[model samples]
Target: MNSNNSVFGQTLAQVHSKFIIVQVLVVIFLCVNLLLIVTFFKNECFYTTTRYILFAVTLLSDSFLFLASDFIFIFNIFRVTMQVSLCSVSCIIVGLYLIVTPVTLTAMTLERYVAICMPLRHAELCSTHSSVHVILVIHGLSSVPYAVIFITFFASASLDFYYQYRTCSVEIFFLYKWQDHVKSAVFQFYFLIMCLIIMLCYFKIMKVARTASGDDKISSRKGLRTVTLHAFQLLLCLIQFWYPLITSSLIHIDFTDLQHVRFFCYIMFNLAPRCLSPLIYGLRDEMFLHALRRCLSCGLYETK
Candidate 1:
């Protein structure tokens, strides 16, 4: 019995350490995202550009996603249960933002395509007002699946379901086994559409990159690289969709291996993709980088 107790203690220690490492990484990324967000606002130049606007939306949504999901993660670690309604709200927010990131990446790719391929109409077509409208549409569409699922659950479940306490995870919201299949279908459908959109944008940008001259060619090439990074980030999101299946298979093979796989997936596929947006835009864009530095210096000066 003491041997079993020792094994349990070791397992608990390992789990806590893993949770701390993940939490630290998320906090670091969140701080970087917040800094970039402040930089965006400080630079009035970003206000008029559609790309910057969309990027700001990505940062905002991703920040919220990290916060909400991390709360759930920490709660799971401590075995903290909450009211079903509250947990559902948190899970819905988490789901909404997960869909938003990839969809926004797709939109950003399309924006680049328009900027490079159709330079003349880019300003008019991809204006600030239009970008905001696109953002609203993205959120609206992303909310549909989760909203439908929740509505179905509430409609069918007893009123006691609302009052009941439960651990907050996506599984708690699942009303039926069919919901899993529906989720897989939604993820697959989204992946297909996003893949096609990014690929089309990439090829279009590539053609422009080959034919254009001097500054236009340089701009086209830059846009091509940006779209490629977006595609990679979207791929990470796609991998996250399959993470559960991967972990589930690992279960029968070895429980210890399953935990490792889960941790690896959570970091690489989940948190790392969220980290890319700032790296892509904040570090890569010279203008944004300059503005970020300026903001940071000013912040330090004020503090001093």
Candidate 2:
């Protein structure tokens, strides 16, 4: 596959370089994520709130997604052909991430909504244990559709040849035409429903926030800013990924011709949330940052 550009019909040197850059970024992201995890676990305060728990969950899920999907970059960097079993497992992991992420995000938004709009009910509705339960339930429920797709896939696909391109989607290369339709429809429908839930929750949150006045006003404004940031992140996901993903059916570009497009989209959409979630969501809390600083400083002094 590393020979002349006959198969892909384009110069692959640039593509190979891009893969290296992305993999380097992924390594950096993994390190920072690990640091935050260790810091959070040490502090009792971090686990006390539902929001923090949800933020931690998002960070963990996003990290796993990057690790699962971007192994292709490593293989591509070495100019190695991926093994069939590894490729199949990679496909399943990536699909699971795609479903799990939006659902978790939806839960995050709802948590924020209740915390802001319905402060009295927030404690009851959004507890650490309940948040963890919701995460488990979301993962469990979303697995059903993907489960059906995966079972049907193995039964139908010949699996004699696996894709050499950066795209690891099994739906595109394997499975019957109708099965592909079922897969895409499941993703789109779930995303649409979850997207609506997020927007509605935030909309109600913003309205309630603006109506507050006096001393409560300051807290409301902070909530407004935080919720807006969440919305912005979702908007980024929509533009970078969901829009292209939805419109993917419109143009039928061959994978080889559009490898660069898919490559960058995966970076921006798939990997970016993992990279940014810790900073944007987790570290935004002043308490978490202070705890992290103290932990690092204590460790530094001990090392000295």
Candidate 3:
């Protein structure tokens, strides 16, 4: 009995530690995202430009994702159960942002491809008006997958399911075993298409870089690196979707060991991907960094 008590205490401490760590990371990223967003609004050039506009949308999606996921994480840590209806709302919001992030990343990559590979048509193809249409299309596409899942939920779930209190998770949508397989297959196909598009953009940009000179060459090379970062970010997002398969393979392991693996994967795949937007855009892009620095300096001067 004494040994069991000691083990329980240790597990409690670990849970507290994990909570604190997650909160700290979320706060840091949210603060950074807010600062970059402010800088984007302060500069007319950034707000008007197609590339920066897409970057801003990516940041906005990341911000919303961080908030929604963090809410779920905290609830799960405390083992709080809510009505299925409430949980469904939170889960749906999280799902939308998750879908939006990768789609926006793909759009950003295509924007770069046009800017470098078709310089003469870049303005006409990627104009501010066109970007608004692109964003609408992205959100529209992101909504379709969730709409199908919600339809399944409503069709399969009895009325009692809505009033029942349960811990929120993606699993709530899986009203039947077949739904899980369908979800997995749909995601697999979606990601395969996205992966192909990014790869194609990279190869096209590479060709442009090889034969180009001076400013055009430099632009194409930078675009290549940017697309590579997008691909890496997409891979991280993809892993979260496949997380169930990863954990299922470890089912034979001790329960505690399995929990530890899940925690690590949550941090690495879920939290880490949301943190990369600032690194890819705010710090890596020379123009944006310059604008951000100038905005910060001006703010500091005004404060003084």
CA error at residue 29 for candidate 2, angstroms? 0.9
Candidate 3 wrong stretches, greater than 4 Å? 250-254, 299-304
Best by TM-score: 3
Best by lDDT: 3
Off by over 4 Å in 1: 247-259, 299-304
Cα misplacement distance, residue 93 of candidate 2 (Å): 1.7
RMSD of 3: 2.0
Write the residue-wise lDDT of candidate 2 on 1-304 in tens digits: 6555564544566666777788798888888888788777887887878877877776677778778767765665446666555667886777677656666767777887787788899888887778778878978965766687777776775656444433344544444677767766666676677678877886786787688888667777777677677766665554433533444563587745466666667777777755557766657878877777778797673355
Candidate 2 achieves a global lDDT of 0.69
Error of 3 at 81 (Å): 0.6
lDDT of 3 by residue, 278-302 (tens): 9999999888888788788986744
lDDT of each prediction vs. the true structure? 0.85, 0.69, 0.86
Each candidate's root-mean-square deviation in Å? 2.6, 4.3, 2.0
- lDDT per residue for candidate 1 within 1-304, as digits (tens), equals 9999999999899889988898899889999999999999887899999889999999999999899988888887677999998998898999899888888899999999999999899989998889889989999977876776777677777888989988777767667877766776776777788898988999989998999999999999999999999999999987777755675466587767765776787778878899899889999999898788779898674455
Between candidates 1 and 2, the lDDT winner: 1
The C-alpha TM-scores of every prediction are: 0.93, 0.83, 0.95
